[model samples]
Target: MLESVLLAGGGSAGHVNPLLAVADELRRRRPDVRVVVLGTAAGLEAELVPAHGYRLVTVPRVPLPRRPTLDWFRLPGRLRAAVRVAGQAIDRSGAQVVVGFGGYVATPAYLAARRRGIPVVIHEQNARPGLANRLGARWARAVAVTFPGTPLPGAQVTGLPLRPQVAELVAARHRDAGRARTEAAALLGLDPTLPTVLVTGGSLGALSLNTAVAGVAADLLAAGAQILHLTGAGKADAVRAAVAAVTRDARPGVALRYQVREYLAEMHQALAVADLVLARSGAGIVSELAALGLPAVYVPLPIGNGEQRLNAGPVVQAGGGVLVADADLTPQWLRSHVIPLLADPDRLAAMGAAARTVGVTDGAARVADLVEGLA
Candidate 1:
């Protein structure tokens, strides 16, 4: 009976991914239901939403003016126009429910849905709810949150939704880790025999992460663990140079098979092959690692409202991952802790199991249920 629904959000993977997951879930539940996405041309959604075969209705980006400038004075008019555009899109799509995942477009979508007397389902993905969701939640007919402690009105804890490929890897991760690891290693051209540590700073790369992990590539390789480091596109050169330096001063016969890459199209494979991961504690990264039951060292970005740290807290408490301050992720600490941890297969397996216990792979289904209720 659900005729149509609009999923609103985008900008980053954190928002867009969940929106797409909900979209996928809705269609899976009822293939006849029409699902549409509302996002700005600037955000990641412009490319991803279209690529995913969803109908994307583009809206002009009207960022909430923060500075005391001319843009601040023009906020009212811009917001009004965006809301009008959203309302028009809603009418055109005949969307019965507007599900919001929080971004620039979310505000207008929330307003438009609220004005049209349509049910609004809000999904807040971060422990620290973003501004758009903070305001939208007040009017949301139903509210879902990825983290339990997220300070939002009437929020039900629905964990971050895993992508389809991630779900497949999670299944493989449970069915046969050894087989998965071998296949993944082969897919990525990595050494299946070696204990592997996957390092990623994110799409743009983290300067702190690249520098610290690159400095310790030799130490890790020497400890019998190879590094599959995704150094972001721009940071790859620096990482390559660092690896070369380590190779030059290497001990007698230590052949460091450290792989440095700009990016990996198949991240699921990376997750499958890795014994450990060192990365930023973004919602998507943390959730994927948890779902796959991969142990990790989460270095929360030392910026924003400390949300990244909060995001990694639950994982750390479950013994699935370790959390370290950005300033504390030195080569010495990595050698002292990571090397010892890598050597202990029992501890690593225990951590991975604990991570699986805390992770919720069926988050998209849960969120879909909430949206369906609104419909």
Candidate 2:
């Protein structure tokens, strides 16, 4: 049996979902192929990979802090542990090819594959390469990217691989517009007459996005707009509390409404119903928004290493959304940009059309073709 190994660990949905998309494609193309994902015991992969009916081999968790401190000393031990775990996992799986999807887990997985004389491929999901992928690039036999202009050498720009639900939404575009709208609204429990805006900052949530949404909750309610907010697990309670407080003060008969959750199980429903979105510019989120033809206001995370800012550029240039600096994401700016669009149906529709133009729904198939060619 042909086997493949995937490296994905220690991150939110941004990291896990792309790996799942590619894995789904791989299974669709080759039913008998056995796929093993190398992940940490603590990450989303532990649950997500197994839930998708694939085996997940646990590797050591070696997370690097965004800022350097005394913890830097732990790096050597962690690296050693990761290398050992990765080597064992690859050997046991008898992997013909190992693909690193960019994370600490990937670093060791790629190294173990190299030492075993197995071919290695790296997939980068950002416009700017991450630290792990940057190092893995040197030994990678093939490199795939989600955006143009990434600095990695010999990389092929394959766009972002979207989940199957998203692909179905794109394919269903030919149906009657009103029917699509009704279906989406019914699925999301939204009032068909009012406009809807989706607010999400990756799967883990962003404080900046949550804060801005809280401050503007009243205004959105007053304008007859509803919200579907996904607050990361860490900040869900705080965001829900703030929204409840705002909703309590809202005037009677105003259609200001919200459905707040820590993580959304029905992202397809939310995306389909949304007329506008406020989110971070993570490559995966950007790709999804574009594919769904949803207009957005993107706030790039201030932490530079995540490379979120670079991910927002294409949609901003395409007039599909506005890119806001994290520090500058105040309630006033959000109100100015979002309220006007919600009030103007024509402009909102235009932005949605522009967003659809930038989407590459065939990204997974393209990347799968490349992988097949390599074999």
Candidate 3:
């Protein structure tokens, strides 16, 4: 077994969270292992890595420009400096193997590890691999991917490494799903028996998703279904206003059925109580919902390289979820499709069952096993 590991990734929660998950699993499995994280001071890891009780070494943030810009010309010098620092950190940690989660820091970490003749392991969270991982995969000792058909050479489908809260929730659901949902509902102040729909666009919020869902809040409440709209940060007031405008002349009880919050600290709690989720189909959320066997309506972000759509493809094709384009997710779409689906418990149950078939709960452990094999 490896005595120490150097974990590299950061910038966003998508990379940092999974890197931490794998680190947690490694520590849990081998208590004596030394785990060190390499990240940039500007990234989420500067805050989260230390909070998780791991040693973090930071290198300058080096972004590889996509278009031919002046920064592209300066890439080699910046990358070399980053790699030099990365090598020093690796040597100090005496890492037996380096595990990378594909972010700005990964290229330097991979090159540094290779220079020292250290084995490198990579974990790609998206179906469409990022530039860093795509480059690292060429020489990585092992490549683990969250989704099937990821175009990485010698990649293994290890699933996304879930956060601890999500992993625990998956275990609880496996033990007794109804009981778990009820307990989680109680904690979240939600009625356990209500058919609840969770609408979110991740932490930054999606204006399109919020507007579309808010436009149909009254209709959902009228169908005896409740709404838990997590309207990203700084966007709740707008959603609230939209819902209020639609239901102003209607029943007094309508407002009581709609809940709007900017964010939930414990998102797994919301996931546990949610019967169905309508949100962006990012790799993290998609894998988390699938792991819990909750049906979802995936709205792929209109931006990016279309990776969000690719991430939701497997679950949708498996009959576990529905995919809608961001532009097409209007009020009419919700009234036409979502309301009726909420009313049909049998169909909802079937969809959840199908989702479970594609879910993976042991991803962290699988990735850890792969890392251990390298040493």
**RMSD (Å) of each candidate, 1 decimal:** 1.6, 2.7, 1.1
lDDT of 1 by residue, 36-152 (tens): 999988899999998988999988877875458888888889899999989999999999999999989999999999999999999888899988999999989899988778999
Which residue pairs collide in model 3, if any?
A: none
lDDT of each: 0.89, 0.80, 0.93
Candidate 2, superposed: residue stretches over 4 Å from native:
1-10, 64-77, 174-177, 234-256
| lDDT rank order | 3, 1, 2
**lDDT (Cα, tens digit) per residue for candidate 3, span 1-375:** 689999999999999999999999999988899999999998889999999999999998788888899999899999999999999999999999999999999999999999899999999999999999999999999999999999999999999999999999998988898998898888888888899999999999999999998888878988998888999999999999988887788777767678899999889889999999999999999999999899999999999999999999998999899999999999999999999999999999999999989999999999999999987
Estimate the overall C-alpha local distance difference test score of candidate 1: 0.89
Model 3 C-alpha lDDT versus the unseen true structure = 0.93
Clashing residue pairs in candidate 2 are 204-232, 221-256
TM-score of 1: 0.97
TM-scores for every predicted model = 0.97, 0.89, 0.98
Q: Considering summed lDDT, which 10 consecutive residues are worst modelled in model 1?
A: 248-257
Preferred candidate (TM-score higher): 1 or 3: 3
Clashes of 1: 0
